[model samples]
Target: MSKALEPAGPSDGVNRWGLVDLFAGCGGASAGFLATGAFDHLWAADNDRWAAATYEKNLGHEVATVDLLEVAESSADVWAAGIRARHRGPICLVGGPPCQGFSSHVKVRGDSRGRNTLYGAFVTLAIALEPEVVVIENVPDLFATRNWELFADARSRLSDAGYRVRARILNFAEFGVPQERFRAVVIASRADHPEVRFPAPTHAQGAFSSVQEWIGELSPVASGEVAEDDAMHQASRHSKATLEIIRQVPADGGNRPIGVGPECLDRTRTSHGGYTDVYGRLAWQTTAPTITARCRTPSCGRFIHPEQHRGLTAREAALLQTFPSNWHFVGPFDDRFKQIGNAVPPLAARRIAEAVLSGGSHSEAGVVEIGDEPIGSSFSVLIPGIRRRGGRLAEGN
Candidate 1:
């Protein structure tokens, strides 16, 4: 591997800027930044042990497996001092605070109340390190709440700390990932620095490759079949009855029968006919639905293979997320799935990182609104921040 591609320890000095990923689930954003050939991996932190281990194994850097709030209140300085000792160059703080509480999938809507506050801790860390730039990625619902309060507050806080912040929602497929994943992105820089702009899409909407293009090369395997040579390629074992039900569902974009068998949702399927994507098969010719933390399970939203009668293996899902084939994840099946699903597609991340490094923007003035045209017919929303250079949202033809 080239020096830029090789995993680096905290001390390796082969790159220009430095990056520390908070909520760094298995180093997705970090890997993307490294791939840009612009930033060196400096430090990382995550609360999950398995995620930290997976990140360390793939990136060759130790992840401080500490809770962000505790670190913020007690030992943030120590973490910042550690990074300073390793690299004195300007650093960029990048992360996606957990968004399950804000996600529409979660019932009751307000269960994990403390989760939203995690962004404040991220801001606290950014303030401690005084990084030159900060990037945050999250679910798009984060920006839609009453007046975009979460976004407004974070931008307000960063601006108070002397950074001009910009937020946008970006679709991963627009940047080369084969999955039609949409995410909210926020970028901030020192007020005196040149204005930061969101990266323009390299792939036009509906012009990108399909799921088969990303994971087609993987050898097909049956449910419960483990590729002895590749640990992540193992699929979940299904019961005999469940296997039969899955076989009955038509292949390639087929959803389970609405009112028949165990495939139909218990109450919601009959009551509201909602969640048609559950137990649906992925179409080989199209980009995949967003991979969620439960992607390893067949019942989780359109994760079934188009041809095979099984849910996606961890390896397949990772490839769809644009993770390198050689990138190894360390964890149990479910944990590995979560790490893969939560990752920022490296292709998308590399583009954004390059934009930040080059200070290249379509325009230097106004807020740049992205994710206006959702890829693969997925929903997209405009975030309220920054004025577009033209004072209008960039629309798609």
Candidate 2:
């Protein structure tokens, strides 16, 4: 539990809409909502202590470090009751549950099932709180053949609760994020209110904001250099061998050199098929790759700086994720990168909040088809164990 870095109160006399954020990592989505000047953050919760601390520091609000799955299973009514008592206006519930299960980057089957159903906890809170609007965000793989049933089940539950729901896969770059990150988003509105519409793209592919425009102006630092004025701008120190490999790779969008680095990454290795982005430098004029929790190192992905020989610093990564330069992330270096990588870009989130406030086109009251099997099929059998386990989806054969 960390104290807010500043006073935690909304401005006076605005009559802003209320928002309750679950899985509120570093307040990224909440930042977007609040940036619209149409919402006041009433409550936010996440299990990560450092992330909660970061949220409190940057958002000027306290975040409860509670396990949402436990709360949804045993005490949703109790929790929702407290929120309801605090605010009596129209409320929007927004969250992105642990999404590793639905991410293409995850290879292990066992690792995927545990958090796959955490969105159920989100649904539980939505049903209990009865928010006027509900939003769920996750990796685009949520609509894949393997995970579609779980997504269908969540949508079915929301629809049964009188919400007109629609799901879409949105690229954050189109919404002005300087990264080519794709996420599946579900927005639901109560039957009485206008359906929640997805916002139109604000930036086309060719005209997207570039990495140069975002972080190029920051003071340059070598691999082991630390900025005295800003801890977030400090770059990670790399090994001598790693530095040699990065130096060999051309600057500005260079791929891992063949037969040059570790033998494990060599073309002769059997496991070196699809990892083209490993040890690669980002292109200055184009959008950066999706920043992951491991983005502080070059071995993880194409996180190496465009011209520098080290991976991206936390500040650069945060800026690529559309977090404001002044947004303070509280934690050790690794923890700060994790918070930034896991956050929904505030710019994209602002568009979503604005769409909710705009009362745009009324979507139909069911799942939006983006190439998946129809709901209520034989796949329905997969959902019971998820609900019974509280949140973890059963390992299906």
Candidate 3:
């Protein structure tokens, strides 16, 4: 909470970023942030033991599995010491508050069960740790909704801390993700530099690019079949009754025939608008719909394979999430699904990471002389639009 934490233009010693991930699941954000070489994960926390274990297993970081609400920031010193011991300074706070309340996938009813209040715990920690930079990722609806006053509270708190916080809804497709993912991202810094902007798009049209183009090479792995590099992968099992329903639905086709029923023919489904992706087969020609937790069930969403008949496996979903094929996961089957479904696409994360780190690259050109730190301190002048490219780096990496 020093004045130096107040916003300032690019300078050395301010940009060398470290990271801490709240709701860290299997280290997806950690993987992305580390891959960018912009920030190192100082520490991470999550309530799920399996997920936290997975994070610790893969990243070898001291991730804690305590409920964030109960954990006191006063006790986070050991973790902070790990950060200070290695990284220079200017830690970056990176996390995605659990967004189930604002998610379109689930109904956000019940005031008492309003899990949105958990977001407040994040800001509380933010104020306590007072990281130089903060990155929050959530569903697009997050910005549009007023759930727990968390957004309002976070906005006020960050600004009160003298941070220039900006929020924008960014599309993952524009950022190089094969899938069309619209998310709300807020990057806050205690002081000023250039206005923090989402990175520019790198995956462009007719460049021989598309969702299909990205995962086109992976041979379709049928349900129950293990991927070559996959160890914990499991293809969703379809019940006999459920399997019968999907047969009637066309690929990339809705169940209106069965959904709305009456004159059209089928009468099984009621068109509840909730279970549309059920038994659905993806169109090889189009991008896959947003990956959801229920995606493991064909009856949930368009969790079906493009050409295959079964739901996509956790590993496949991870690939679609732009995680490297070789990228590993630890945990049981269900835990694996939750991890992949909840992870920040490494591709999308890196776009912001590169942009955050791009200042050093720019300073090398003498265009901007950012301080020692990367993101919070420096602003990218050369390719400030880098965050927009999303998953495009998958091709090169």
Candidate 4:
């Protein structure tokens, strides 16, 4: 957005730009951006110590463990001066704020959720740094009726700060992530530069990378078995009843057999309203369901291995999320799953980085408003403007 200086070309033998990642969960976004070899990692911050350690381990950059709220509360000018001194080149600010408040899976939905406003901290930093481009990622439900006002507020604030703001609901599967994950991405570019455009889909319906392609090569491990070579390939120990239920589930994308799970899952029961994907197996040839923090458990969504009688290993889940096999996660088993599930797929992030590098052209297909369904409904209710095609949402022009 700052026209005075452009990113240096590869011929110049100089780093093009500086990247500052906020709320960097294990450096997924940073990993992708760095893969393009266009930006230098200037700084990264996250509150979780384990996540910080993991980021430092993989990215070779120290992550500030302080909460961003404190950073936002400090003297903006002082922080801006310090950051500018470190990297004089153009800067890009990228991050995904904590999205639990806007996640459709959460039981509670409202403006009162404190985490809902954390995006403001990101906005505060962006204004202070006056970065050329700012990218904010979150759950698509950020556009839901309940949170639309907050979404609008963020756009307005960035616009008032002299940025041209655009937003879109992007399916990660379209970007070749081996899972079906949708996220709302907001990109704001300073008025001087061309509007930052959303990246086009690199993979389409039947051509999407399959779950088997990502994880099938990992040595098969039964429930409670740990691969000797890959410690992260360890599987969770299932109870006898849970193992029996998993055994009853047929291979390759089978739903839990009738009466195989809890009574709440029984369709004949009057109170039966549970999710059907619970305890289901993923199809080997199709993209996986959205990987969540609970992906290590068989009862959480369609997490069970296609043919194995166990849920996904942490390593397998990371693969489905498009993490490299060599990327090591540091934490307890559950914590490792949380880090992997919360990451923005590096492949999707790489496409976004490439778009930024190309100085994208404006597109009318950027923003898609959601329907006015109950926020807590189990199913996503998209309006006619956005249609489901081949498991991916097509943007209305």
Best by lDDT: 2
Q: Model 4: which ten-residue window has the lowest total lDDT? A: 1-10
Which segments of candidate 2 are over 4 A away from where they belong? 1-15, 99-117, 268-273, 361-397
Can you give the TM-score per candidate against the true fold?
0.83, 0.84, 0.73, 0.87
- For model 3, what is the C-alpha lDDT against the true structure? 0.61
- Local distance difference test values of all predictions, in order: 0.74, 0.78, 0.61, 0.78
Model with the higher lDDT, candidate 1 or 4: 4
Sort the candidates on lDDT, descending order: 2, 4, 1, 3
**Model 4 Cα lDDT, one tens digit per residue, 1-397:** 0110122345253547789999999988988887777888898999888888889998899998876766675676687788899997778899998634334422344444333346766787888999988988888877766676566777778889999887777777777788877788888899987677788777776787889888888899999999999998989999999999999998999988777879777764336555778889999999998999999898878999999999999999888877778788998888999999888888878878877767755332233533333233212655222334434344333
Q: What TM-score does candidate 1 reach?
A: 0.83
lDDT of 4 at 348: 79
Cα lDDT, model 3, residue 147 = 36
Local error of candidate 1 at residue 69 (angstroms): 1.1
Which pairs of residues have clashing backbones in candidate 2?
Answer: none
Worst window of 10 by summed lDDT in candidate 1: 383-392
Q: Sum up the clashes in candidate 3.
A: 23
What TM-score, to 2 decimals, does candidate 4 have? Answer: 0.87
Sort the candidates on TM-score, descending order: 4, 2, 1, 3
| Candidate with the greatest TM-score versus the true structure | 4
**Model 3: runs farther than 4 Å from truth?**
1-15, 72-86, 99-116, 192-195, 204-209, 227-229, 251-276, 359-397
